[model samples]
Structures are given as structure tokens and as C-alpha cells.
Target: MNGSPASLDAAAMTNASVEVVRDVVYGHGLVHRARPGGPVPRALKLDLYLPARHAHTAPRPALIMAFGGAFHRGSKENDAFEAEGGNTSVADYCLRFARRGYVACAIDYRLVTEDPEPGTTPVVSAPERIPTSRTDVVRRIMNLPPATPDMLWRGIEAASDDMAEAVRFVRSRAAEWHVDPARIALGGFSAGARTALNVAFGEKVPVAAVVALSGFMDRADLQRHLSGFDGGPAVLLVSAENDLDYIAEATPGLVAQLRAAGLHCELLDVPGAGHFYQADAVAVHDAHGATTVERAMAGFLRRTLGG
Candidate 1:
């Protein structure tokens, strides 16, 4: 979706009263053309948030957060989840980091279905066809897919390129945002997480660290190559017991590979949580109650981005 202020302002205001308790911060959203690609034929844009009271130094640590929608659909806006007190959007998380003294940017990347070829039937049909019991309609939307291995690989590459461009774009305009260029890290969920891992683990781009919530690294060979790079970004992988996706099973192996390659990696498997921890209302209740994901993410940022 468009990251226009009008589009996000209401959500932000609706969530304003929802206090995260740990930190208080302010964030702003800007739409910048990071690259020119896809059928849209326009500059791909992303939203950035800065910590409260942050002053631009020569270099400031930053975090690039990406959301997941199975590589076919997703927006920075998708992180909005309703809780008892108020709502928590991905923007809120970005603001939290900004409050803690880090520049956080949630990005919008091109997805597979952005402009599907005319008359070509999609590999995965409508969400209603999936028999999942989750009531979240968004999850149903994520069920549609480019199911083939080739399509999956292509999506991964496109997203990786988009992410690389975003990193470069942020650093390129660091002066304008009062951000430090050297300490940028990356975070994403599911497919977005996959993109983060692929890019961070790939040779094409270099980041300080990567935080993945239920994401796996593609192209094992490329991951091995990343392992050999000295001081490559540290990685944090978070998953839950109820995760039915390949990520839960795959992360351990990826962690092993990264460690074998001499890269620092940390994994957190939340007990009884599912594919998307926020998928179920009760799970959301439990996750929020424990502050499991947020706590881990905060700790990770403090170490990796110096927030």
C-alpha cells in the first residue's frame, strides 16, 4: 500500500494511546523512491523513523525492518495488531527504536503479484481455498502464492535486490535524515525475514546485523560464502513451537551453517507460538503479555545497532 501520511495517520493516532511501556519515541514516515522497477514503473519507496531526541552524528546506527506476506503481498503497514490497551503497528516498533536512539526504517518492497502477466493463472488460488482455521483475513491473503521453486527463487532475488537498494538509499540520504550510515541492521517477518536473511547472508550487500522472525536463508551456498566474510552481520532468528512453516525446522540448520562459517547467530523459539505469533487473538494476548518478541528485538537492537 501507499505509505502516504493520510493512509497511515489514522492508524498512528488510533495507536497513540497504546503505550509500549519500555520506551517512548516519535517517528515519521517518508516515501522515497529507492529504485525504479516492476510494472508500477515508478520509484519504489520506503518509510523511515528516527529516535526521539536523536542528533545526527558522523554515523548513527540504523535498523531496516521489512514485513512478510509470502512474497506476493505485504506492506510496512501490515504490522498493525490490535491489543487490549491499543494497537501496535510496525511503525510503532520503528518509533520505539527511534525513542531508544536509533534510526529505524520500515520498507516496502515489490511483490510477485504487483503486476501479474495478463491471462496467466496464479499458481496458488484464492485464500478461501486454504483450510487454515485462523480468523485473521490477512493470513488468508498470505496463503496465495507463486508456489513453484523457480518463482520462489525469483521472488527472493527481487526482494534481496530491493532490500540492497533500500540500504544504499538510506545511507545515500543519511545526511538528510540525520542517520549514521555505518551501523545499519535489518529485520523482517516470514518472507520479509527470508529476504533479510538472504540479503544479509549474500555477498551483494553488507549489513551490521539481521533480525528474522520466522525466516530462513535461501541458497545454502551463498550463506556459506557469507560465513567466510569476517565481521559479517550477526543474525537473530525467532520462531515458535506452533510454527508449521519450514522456517522452524530450517533455522537450526542455517544457524549451524552460520556458526560453522564463524558468524555469530542467536535463535529464540517461543513456546507454543504459531507460524505468525499474532495470527490468533489469544496468541497475541500471550505474546504481548510476555513481551517476548519485542523484548528479544529490543535486546538485539541494543547490541547490534547500539540503540
Candidate 2:
């Protein structure tokens, strides 16, 4: 308050501090605290990584990150849901944004498993079925409950719906959170990536950009919640060249759709990487797997949402 006009102007131009803090809570109308110890769902909360008070005096662009678990198991810590440092985004991958002075949030979404009477087996084809499709690939490897074409799709729809509300939730607290209501971006890995795509193309929300890491969605499914509006937001898609899921389907179609709709979109192929780059390919590729994608993400956010 007692600085020269020149000094104050400089301070305003550049964020003066890098201090980081976190706030977590359920979104509006999403708070459902279960009775003391009843299988409460994983806390429907997001951890925010914020900069210093001075830096946030003006609204800052925000990013909401969803983790990928093939639509059944990822979390805010999707980068390492089962390994150490898997609970909070502040400790793992999402924390990288704090240095850049952007408020980043890692969110967890509802994951529902198909239910069937125990010991009552699922109907199997006359011949032992060879699994196919991205869902089938993940289902076999993860040993998850038997899923039908219908169930897996329902899962994606549910996750994307939550993402739409999460954007609204962040804007609802724009003043308190110091986040620019108009500059929010969405991105995620694996299944989370699919949800991000759905959030931008599948429905209407005030989104500036989208970053998808190894994710995809069907046009018809995305059409289920379409809200006619202005031009769509920019999008970036990243997938492993070896990812059985999209090397042939999804990404190609998605890129075509974005272009046909007159929207800007980019796709980066991660060579030698699998579906889960952080978990499976980082070490083998000497960090190119994750670093390249993160760099692309930073560049995309900067170009589309600005600081």
C-alpha cells in the first residue's frame, strides 16, 4: 500500500508471491454426508492449489483435473491411485501448476459397478469370448465386474455430468476462490480424459479449452446432453500410439468431428506408451511420456485460456 506508482504497477503485472494453499469441499447440492461409517463414497471433494493473496487479488485461470481409471477406478490422484501419494493432487502430478500460479483442482467422480446376483453367472457366448473394445481390454486386465456395452457407457455419461456441475461449482465461488469465471479449462487422463471431452463437446458449459490424455467418446452418446450455443471450445487429444483403444477408433473420429464443427483441435501421439502413461510408460520412456503431455497441456492452456 505504500509503494511508488511504478513499483505498484510492476507488482500488479507480475504475481508477487508463489505461496500455495488448498481448499476442499463438495459442490453445490452435491454435499451428502453419510451417517457415521456407512460406506461413504470417496469424499466428493477437490483440492485446490492456490497462490498468494496478492497474486489472486485478480481472478486467475483455473483447471479442473480428473483422473483416469478406465471409468471404474481412477481418482483425484489418478496418476497413482494405488501407489504412494495417491490421495491429494497437491502431492503428485496436479501440484505442478502451483509454480505457474494457476489454481488447479483434482476431482473424484462416482464409479458404479454393474450388479448381478452373486454366483449367478453372466451370459457367455457359446464360445469363450475374446475380449475386445477399450472397455473390454480394461475389464479383463483390471478384473473388474462384468460390464456390458450399456453399463460402460452409462459410467462415462455419469462422470461427464459431474464435470459439468464442477465447472458451475467453481464459478459459483468465483469471488471467494479468485478464479476467473470465464477462463476455466478441463483435462484428464484415460477415462477422465473421456469425461473432459464429454464436458466440452457432450454438453454446454462455459469452458475455454479441453485437454484429453488417452480418452474418447461416441458422437451419439455425447449428443444425449447437447445444449445448442456459440462455437465450441478448443481441444487437445493425447493418446498412446500403442493404446489399443484409440489408435483405430475414437481419436480419429473425434478430431474429424472437432474440425468439421469448425473448432480448433490437436492430437499428440505418445509412442511406446500404454493407456496409463504415468503408471506404465514413464520410466521406460525416460519421462517423455508424461513430460511431453504436460508441456503440451501448459502450452494449450496458455494459448487458449491465457494467464
**Model 1 ranges off by over 4 Å:** 1-40, 55-59, 80-89, 115-146, 222-224, 278-291
Off by over 4 Å in 2: 1-23, 28-43, 54-56, 81-91, 114-134, 137-143, 220-229, 278-291
Q: Could you tell me the C-alpha RMSD of candidate 1 in Å?
A: 8.7
Pick the lDDT winner: 2
lDDT (tens digit, per residue) of candidate 1 on 1-307: 1234443444344444321111111222222233345333434556666443344244568888777766666577565433222223455567666666677777776665443222221222222332222223443556653254444444455666677778887777677667767688888877777778767766347787888877765434445455447668888877777664556657678878777777777777666656656422231212223446677777766666674
- Writing each residue's lDDT as its tens digit, candidate 2 over 81-173 gives 433222222234455665576767777666545221111111111112212365565577788656765555445555766677678777887
Q: Give the Å error, residue 82, model 2.
A: 9.3
Note the clash tally of each candidate.
Answer: 3, 0
Q: Whole-model Cα lDDT per candidate? A: 0.59, 0.60
Give the lDDT of residue 103 in candidate 1: 75
TM-score per candidate, chains pooled = 0.70, 0.72
